[model samples]
Every structure is written in C-alpha cells, then in structure tokens.
Target: MSPRILILGGGYVGMYTALRLQRKLRRGEARVTVIDADSYMTYQPFLPEAAAGNLEPRHVVVPLRRVLNRCTLLSGWATAIDVAGRTVDFSPHRGESRKIEYDVLIVAPGSVSRTLPIPGLAECGIGFKTVEEAIHLRNHVLAQLELAASTTDQAVRREALTFVFVGAGFAGVEALAELEDMAHDALRYYPELKADELRWYLIEATDRILPEVGPEMGRWTLEQLRARGIDVRLGTKLESAKDGRIVLDDGTEFDAATLVWTAGVKPHPIVRHSDLPIDAKGRVKATSRLTVEGVDGVFAAGDCAAVPDLTNPGEYTAPNAQHAVRQTKVLADNVLAHLRGGKMGDYRHAYAGSVASLGLHKGVAQIYGRRLRGPLAWFVHRTYHLSRVPTVNRKVRVLIDWTLALFFRREIVALGALSEPRREFELATRDK
Candidate 1:
C-alpha cells in the first residue's frame, strides 16, 4: 500500500506543498489529502482592496479543490491529532466523526486574530483577516452612509461618520487606508455627507507602525497617514468600545460605528490541542529542516510554526507571507525526502524587504536595501501581488478587474442586501 499523507490547513504552506508533492512524487508512491475549514486559500494581502470594492472578492481567493486536482480535498476541520495512536480524528461539515491514518502528517493550520480581553471589543470590533470580514465591512461602511443620509440626529450621524482602527500593522494600516479611500470616494455620492464630516482614528500601542518596513519607512508611513487626515496616535491603547462608545487609555472617548482590530494573530487553536512541543508563544517548535521537534514524521510551517531562521540567528522566521511561501518548497522537499529516504534541505532565506499600500496610488516599499515611496511603490505592490496570486485563471481575473477599473469609475454601490438575503422573505412570510 502507498503511504498516506495528511495535510492540515490549506493556506500557502499546505496548498503549495501539496502542489509541489503531486508533481515530484510518482504515482502509487504516496496518497495525499488536505483538510481545511474553507475550500479556498485567501491571498490575505488583498483583504483591504476587497473591503474597499477595488477588486471582486472572488478573484483574491484561490479555490483549493480546483487547484489541488490530484489530492483529496476534504472540507472539514481536524478536531484532533493522535500523536501516539497514529491517527487523525476529523469532523466533516455534515457527518459523523472519522479517523484517518497517515504515514506522514503536515500541520500548517494558519493563525487567527490575536485579540485582547478588552470590554466591548468582542461585540464592536471586526477583523480584516478573511474575505467574509472584508465583505461585511464594505457593506457596513456603505450602510452607515445610508443611515447618516436618511437621519437627522446629529449623534447618530457623528457615530456613523467616526471610524476607529486599532493596531497599525500591515493589515490594519492597509485596510484602513484602502477603506478610507473608498469612504472618501463614496462621499461624493452622498450629498448630505461632506468629506470633512468623516473622522478617522488610528490608535497604536507602540511608538511606530509597519515595523516590517523598517524605522524610516515606518515613520514615513505614519507621516503619510497623518497627512491624509488620519488621527495617528502612537503609544496609545484602546480602553474600550462597549456599546460602540470609543474610549482610549489617554482619557479620550467618543462614539464610532466602525472599529477594526488588526493587532496580530496567534497560532491556530489546533496547535495547542495537539501534543506537540510548543514554545512560549504557543507555536509549534520546529527545526531549520521544518520538522516539528520531537515529533517523528510530523512537520509544521507557516504562521503556526516557530521555525529557526538560520540567516537570522536567535530568532524564528517572522510570520509573514514571504517566509511562509518560501518555506513551503523546502518543507515539501523535506517531506518527500523523508518518505523516499533521500536527503533533506534546511529552510533559510535572508530578509528580502517589505511593501505596503496606502490607498490606490500611494505605497511604501523597501527591497534589497533600497527604499521607495509614493506611486512607484504602489505600482510595485500591485505588480508583485498580481504575480504572487495563485492560478492563471485567478491572475487573469484580477488583472481584468484592474483593467476594467482603469477604464471606468469606481464601483461604489453597496449591496448590503447580499448580507441578509432572507430578511425580505422572512418579512413577507410574517406579513402574510
């Protein structure tokens, strides 16, 4: 019988690793299967654009089943991993639990939003991680304009016009910038709402933002955001937002309709459930070879694994797409070598650089020790991400989206009705 390989999570690591393995391994050498909660892999960097309606949500995500043709695609969650028993207990979308035995296991269940125990945050804050959040945010933002236009209450309008975003990392900054741009453009359609009436606040606990782009670029980004009328507050913490009333640690308080939390992410909860050796940060401890320490035949990578960075000693690889995507090749090779008794390779890559988008025509990038800002950086951001999105179909779709966008005005129409498709039916049924 051929060896059965089970891969958890369908993020960059899981998808790319499976893609590579299917080509490298001969038929009958191994059977591969991937199980994920969602059937698509989100190119997370585009969540901001998706939220802003700059790109269709469908184009940013790669459908896993269509791409992983040779591998079994299971749309489910891996509830448990039996390390000693050599089996994985999985729960399907609709069915009884089942156990699958595998000769090799790959754990790459990506991270989830790392949240703090702040009051009201649970109810008021939305994350910019998945495509669903992006869609919901877009709908909500447009809905707010509708609410403000139709209302005469100053308090209600004030609340709807105020936007607050916590955590100024790449996700937070880009999302805020893009969404802000959308809102700014959207205001042109709302005669009652003036651009000056909208208020945006970006609250960060640290002294700087976008640390991945280095100090100079980070500072420049802050200045740019401030210049765009975003209230950039450094060394500030969100006190609370219970009942949609914003309160800050610096003794400031206000009402806001939108609060986005993009602080960071923690390892997927499944890692803690497994009996793997974890580090202080709750990440699976992995060697430079990408093997989970002390777990035979089990490998971990991506945002969940604490893989040692050979080039940068004394530190694990940063949880970024650049490292995560690069690590997958080495990880797939190592897994294949382990199965075939071949030599394994270590995962090592120096920090190349970083890129961030500030709205549509503005950006910052630091590549190979060169710093670039403004329109060139923005163009590079688009060009690089377009190339990185998986599948020729999706790349073409995204490029078409951009091409069409260039020839036409921005599509600012809000289809909030999409979120609650059944509401009208329910109301009709009740009336009858």
Candidate 2:
C-alpha cells in the first residue's frame, strides 16, 4: 500500500511542502492530505500592501484547491495529534470529529499572535495576522476617519483620529506605515480633516524598530518616521487598554479608537496539544535536517518548529517569511529523500538579511551585510518579495497591480458594511 502523508496547516510550510511533494512524488508513492482552517494560503508578506489597497486581497491568497489540486485538501481544524498511534484527530467545518492515520506526518500549523495580559487587550486591540484582519483594519481605519470628519464632539473626533500601534516588528511597523500613508492620502478628500489631526503613535517595548535591517537602518527609519511627525515612543510598553484608553508604562495616556497589536508570535497552540516532542518555547523540536527530533517519518519547519540555526550554533533560526520560504524547499527535498531511503541533507542557509517597506516609496533593507534605504530600498523590497511570492500567476497579477498603481490614486473608500451585511436587513425587518 502507498504511504499516506498527512500535513497539518496550509500556510507557508504546509502548502509548499504539499506542492513540492505532489510534483516530486511518484504515482502511488504517497497520498498527501493537507488540512487547514482556510482553503487558501495567504501570502502574508503582501498583507500590508493589500490593506493599503496597493494589491487586491484575493491576489494575496492562493486557493489551496486550485494550487494543490493533486493533494487531498481538507478544510478543518487538527484538534490533536497522537504521534504514538500515528493518528490525528480532526474536526471539519461542520461535522463530527474524525481520526486520520498516516505513515508520514508533517506539523506546520505555524504561529499565532503572542499577546500579553494587558488590561482589556482582548476586547480593545486588533491583531495583524490574517488577510481578514488586514482588510478589517483598513476598513476600520478609514471608517474612523469618516467618524472624525462628521463628528461634532471634540473628544469623539480626537478619539476617532488617534491611531495607536504596539510593537516595532515587521507586522506592526509595516502595517502602521502603510495604513498611515493610506490615511494621509485620504485626507485630501476630507475637507473637514487635516493631516496633522490624524495622530499616529508607534509604541515599541524595545529601544529600536526594524531590528532585522541593522542598527544604522533602524535609526534612519526612526528619523524618517519622526520627520513625518509620527509619534514613535521607543522603550515603552502598553500598561493597559481598558475602555479604549491606552496607558503606557512611560506615563502616556490616550483614548484612541484604534489599537493594533503585532508584538510577536508564539508557536501555534496545536503544537502543545500534539504528542510531538516540543522545546521550551512550545515549538516542535526539529533536527537540522528538518525532521522532528527523536522521531521517524515526521518532519517540521517554519514558525511551528525550532529549527537550529547552523550558522549561529546556540540559537534557532528566527521565525520570519525569509527563513520559512527557504526552509520549505529543503523540507520538501528531505521528506522525499527520507521516503526513498536516501541521505537527507541538513537545512542550512545563513541569514541572508531583511527587507521592509515603510510605506509607498519608503523602506529599508540589509542584504548580504549591505544596507539600503529610501526609494531604492523600497524598490529592492518589492522586487525581492515579488520574486519570492509563490506562483507565476500571482507574480503577474501583483505586477499589474503595481503598474496600475503608478498612474492611479489610491482607493480610500471604506467598506465597513462588509463585516455586517445582515445588520441592515435585520433592522429593516424589526418593528420601528
């Protein structure tokens, strides 16, 4: 009988692994089954651009069924993995729980936003992890502008216009920068609102921002943002966010309708529930060869796996798209080699560097120890990511989006009603 290969999650690792296996595996060699909550794999690096209306949201996500046509795509949640029994417990979108047996298992559910116990954070703050979140945030930001423009109360207008973002990582920085640019561009249409009135604050617990781009670039980014009148409070932490009131450890207090949290990410919670051996950080313990440590016929990579950094012996590779995308190639190759009784190679790629877009025509990059900033870095950021974002179909679509953007003004219209399409219907049906 052919081996049944079960893959958990359809994000960067899981989707790429399945894609590679489908192409490389001989007919009847293995049955690849990929299970994920969503049927589409989001190219998360393009999320900020999508939110800023630079790229269509649909283009940023690859349909699993479309891409992994050869693999059995299961739209469900992997509740538990009994590694000892070689069976996984899964629950579909609307069905009874089922157990699936597999000869080879790959766990790559990826990471979730790492949040802290700050007061009222769960209710008050929003995360920047998914495409849905990105779209909602964009709509919410634009809606806030509308609210500020038409509101008569000074406090209400002030609260509506103030946007606060926590964390200085890529997600937080990029999202904040892009959204701010979009909002700034939008101000030309709002005769009642001024650009200066649209207050933007960036709160980072650390002293620096965009640490991936080196200290010099980080400092330069800080200066650039400051020059644009963005309030960047470094070495600050959010003490509380109760009732939409942002209280920082630095003694700053503000009532803002918007708060974006992109502090960091932890290994997906499924990792802890699984029978796989996990490191102290709650990530699957992975060998340098991309196989789970102390386990046979099992592999792990991406954010969910603590893959040892061969270049830096005491540390694991940083959880980022750069490493995740590269690791997938090695992971797929190793999995195939293992199945065929061939020698598996170690996953070793020295940290190439990082690229980050600060907004339209603004960015920073550090590649191969060389640093770049401004429009050149921004171009480099787009070019590098454009090459990396999976599929020729998406690459062409994204290029067209960019090409069209050159001559077109940004579409700033907010569609807040999309989230509550039934609200009007329900209200109309009710007795007035």
Candidate 3:
C-alpha cells in the first residue's frame, strides 16, 4: 500500500507541504490529502487593503481546490488526532464524522483570535483575521458614513462615526490607518459627515506599537497616526465594551459602533485533542526539523508548533507569516528528504527586519540593517508583500489593482448584509 500522508489545516504550512509533496514525489508513491475548514488560503497581509477598498476582497484569497489540484482536498475541520494510532477524526461540511488513518501526519492547525472575558466583546466587537471580517469592516465603515449623513441627531451621528481599535501591532495599526484613510475619503460623498466628526481611537496596553519594527519605527508610527487626527492611547487597555460603549482602564469611556479586536492570536484549541507532546503555551513541541517530539512520521509547523529558533537561545519562533512561509520551505524539503531515504535538515532562519504600511503611500521599515520611512518604506512594504503573495495569477491581479488605484478613486461600498446570510430567516423565525 502507498504511504498515506495526511496534512491538517490548509494554511501556509499545510498548503506548501502538499504542493511540495505533489511536485517531489512521483505518481503512486504517496497519497496526499489536505483538510481545512475553509476552502481558500487567505493572503493575510493584503487584508488591510481589502478592508480599505484598495483591493478586491475576493482577490485576497486563493481557492484551495484550484491551487492544490494534485492532492485530495477535504473541506472540513479536524476535531481530533490520535497520534499513537496514526489516525485523524474530522467533521466534514456534511454527513457523519469520519476517521482516516495515515502513514505520516502534518499538524498545522494555525491560530485564532485570542479574546478576553471583557464584557460585550463577543456580542459587539469584531475580529480582524479572516477575509470575511475585512470585507465586512470595509462595508461597515462606509455604512457608518451613510448613517451619519442620514441622521440629524448629533449623538446618533457621533455614535455611528466613532471607530475604536484595540491593539497596536501590525494588524491594529495597519487596519486603523487604512480604514481611517478610507473613512476620510468616503466623507466627501456625505455632506453632513466631516472628517473631524469621525472619532478614531487606537487603544494599546503596551507603551509602544509595532514592537516588531523596533522603538524608533514605533514612535514614528505613533506620530504619523496622531498627525492624522487619530486618538492613540498607549499604556491603556480596554476594560469593557458593553453595548458598544468602550471603557478604558484609565477611566475613559465612549460609545462606538465599530470596535475591532486585533490584540493577538492563540494556538488552535484542536492541538489539545491530539496525543502529541505540547508546550506550556499549548503548542505542539517540535524539533528544529519541524517534526513532532517523540512521535515519528508526524510533523508540525506554523502557529500551532513550538519549533525552536536556532538563532535565538531559549526562544521558539514567533508566530508571524514571515517565519511561517520560510519554515514551510524547510518543512517541505525535510518531508521530501524523509520520503526519499535522505537525511532530514534542520530549520534555522535569522530574524529579518519588519515593515508596516501606514495608509496608502506611507510606510516605515527597517530591513537589512537599513532604516527607511515615508514613501520609500511604504513602497518597500508593498513591493515585498506583493512578491510574497503567491501564484502568478494573484500577483498580476494585485499589481493591476495597485496600478488602477493610481488613477481611480477607491470604492467604499458597505455591504453589511454579508455578515449575516440568514438575516431574513432569523427575523421570520423570531418569536413575537
């Protein structure tokens, strides 16, 4: 029987591994199967552009079936993994739960939004991880302007136009900057809605934002955001968000219809269901080679695995797309080496500098020991991510979007109905 290689989660690691295996291994050598909850691989870096109306939402995600044509694609979620038995249990989109035995396993379930027990968060706030959220935010931001324009009441206008973001990392800063740019531009269409009337607040518990980009870049980012009339509150945390009323730990309070939570992400809880060894943070204990500790034929990578950072002592790799993509290459090569009776190689990558976009045509970056700010850094930010976005088709589409944005205005249509597909059904089924 051919070796059955099962990869869980179709994120960076899963998709790259399956693609590499399909290319490296000859036909009938191994049966590769990839399972994921979603049918698309989201290029997360482009999410801010998608939210800001700079790029189309559909272009930010690649359909898995179209990309991974060689492998068996299962659109489902893996519920449990029995490492000892070499089998995986998953719940498909339809039908009964099923189990599939595998000769080798790759666990890369990735991460989810790490939320807190703060009041009204789950009921009121939105996460900024998925493509759906980006699209929804784009529409919602535009819709807020519409609401502000239609309402004569000052309080109603204030509430509708207020936007709050929690966390100052890349996700929060970029998202806030992009949306603020979009909202400011969108106000031109609404005579009643002034750019100054829209309240934009960025709350962070830490003293600085964009820690990955270092202190100097972070300070520059703060100044840039403040210059744009953003209320950037550092060393402050969100205490509560009940009924869209935000309460900061510093005793500041305000009502905002738009609250985005981009604080951080935690490992997928599905890692706990597996018998594989896990670290204190609940991530799979993986060696430098990306193999599960004490478990042969099982490998792990991406956000779900605690793969050691060889360059840094007493530290594992940080969960970022930069490391994830680089690690995927090593993991793929090692997986191929293992199959061909060749020696597996270790994963060792030096930390690369970080860059961030502060709205369109504005950016900060420190790369290869060189510091850059303003348009140069912003151009570098776009150039680097565009290069990394994957596939020639997507690259061309994204480039075209960028080229068109130079001459044309951004589209700021809010389709809030995208969030709730069964809104009418829910309303009709409601008890009167």
In model 1, where do residues sit more than 4 Å from their true spots?
Answer: none
Query: Residue by residue across 1-432, what tens digits does model 2's lDDT show?
Result: 999999999999999889999999999998999999999999998999999999999999999999899999899899998989999999999979999999999999999999999998999999999999999999999999999999999999999999999999889889999999999999998999988898999999999999988889999999988888899999999999999999999898989999999999999988989889998889999999999989999999999999999999989999988788888889888888988999999888898889889899999899999999999999999999899888999999999999999999979999998899899899999957
Each prediction's Cα lDDT score? 0.92, 0.93, 0.90
In candidate 3, which residue ranges exceed 4 Å CA deviation? 421-432
The runs of at least 3 residues in candidate 2 whose Cα sits more than 4 Å from the true structure, single-residue gaps closed, are none
lDDT of 3 by residue, 186-288 (tens): 8778877667888899999989999998898889889999999999999999999999999999999988999999999989988999898999888999999
lDDT, candidate 2, at 355: 89
- Candidate 3 versus the native: TM-score? 0.97
What are the models' TM-scores? 0.99, 0.99, 0.97
**Clashing pairs for predicted structure model 2, backbone only:** none
For candidate 1, the 10 contiguous residues with the lowest summed lDDT are 408-417
* Ranking 1 against 3 by TM-score, winner: 1
